[model samples]
Target: MKKIEVVAAIIQHDDKTLCVQRGPAKFDYIHHKFEFPGGKVESGETGEQAIIRELQEELRLDISKADYFMTVDHTYPDFHITMHGYICPVESREIVLTEHIDAQWLSINELPQLDWAAADIPFVEKLMAE
Candidate 1:
């Protein structure tokens, strides 16, 4: 199995967390569902670097700073993945969604209502529990 490293961001603003709907690439399992914005870490790239690049590519914003929040280790039949999650605040609200089919800003209370990626469930639970 291929070992993959991914970075996910739990971006928050004014008590609302940013979530994106899965696009075509992720349409099979829970298509169009909410998830934290992130992608696989590239070769020779750090998790932080991948997250920053992905945020810029997907949201069109330069991430000045991001804090590591959680790390989730998951194994699938096809691949093994280690996802690192970060929490950060963007400079503005003008997000240009280039990859996601849809995006929403939901409160922690609302998180439980939406269907999230399997690996993201624990993070959401943790956030909801706090």
Candidate 2:
């Protein structure tokens, strides 16, 4: 199976982490699934660059500082994906969402409150264990 490589920003503020729910714009089984804000790394772009670009486009926010977290590989019924997770620190709690249906600032303890995208579950588990 072919693999799709992506990057994600686990943007956190204080004790709250930023999570986004996919909008109707996404496809079946993918849409409405909760996830960190980010997207696929385009050709010629580094994973860091991709997350930075995706953040600007999706949330209209900037991540001035970020720390590498972990990489996870996941296979869904339809496709396989590799995700690079980063802990992105932003200057503001404000965001303007253009792609997602909804956004939330939830504590790590609340991470399991919503249904998450399959691939993101591993990272979530890793996060809470920290």
Candidate 3:
């Protein structure tokens, strides 16, 4: 198995965290679950750079800064992924929604109600604790 690094942006505004519905391609693991907006960190790209670039490309907004939130190492049957999660406040409200089917900002208290990706459970717990 190969190691993959992913950057996830956990943007929060007015106590709501920005989440997106995973695309059809994610059926293997996440399926239709909701997740923080982000993606894989390409080779030679720093974690911060990956988050900034991914957010810009996926959401069409300029991310000012990404604050480190948590780092999680998750293993699946086929591969292992290390995710660097960040909480960044969005400067622009405009989102392109290129890959995801839907997006929304949900309150921390209501996070448990949403069907989230399995790996997101720990991150959401940390967010709720804060």
Among these predicted structures, which one has the highest lDDT?
2
What lDDT does candidate 1 reach at residue 73?
86
lDDT-based ranking, best first? Answer: 2, 3, 1
Give Cα-based local distance difference scores for all models. Answer: 0.83, 0.90, 0.84
How do all models score by TM-score? 0.90, 0.94, 0.92
**If the candidates were sorted by their TM-score against the true structure, best first, what order would they fall in?**
2, 3, 1
Between candidates 2 and 3, the one scoring higher on TM-score is 2
Q: Which candidate's TM-score is highest?
A: 2
- After superposition on all C-alphas, the RMSD of every candidate to the true structure, in Å, is 1.7, 1.3, 1.4
Candidate 2 global lDDT: 0.90
On the 0 to 100 scale, the lDDT of residue 3 in model 2 is: 84
lDDT of 2 by residue, 14-99 (tens): 88899999987435777789999888999999888999999999999988876889999988777799999999977679999899
Per-residue alpha-carbon lDDT of model 1 for 1-130, expressed as tens digits?
8888889988888888898888765335556667888888899998789999999998886777889988998776667778899887875667899988888888999998888877788789888888
Kindly list the per-residue Cα lDDT of model 3 for residues 80-128, writing each as its tens digit. 8889999898655567898788998788888888888877778999988
Q: Give the C-alpha miss distance for residue 49 in model 2, angstroms.
A: 0.8
Clashes of 1: 0
Error of 3 at 93 (Å): 3.1
Can you give the lDDT of residue 121 in candidate 3? 78
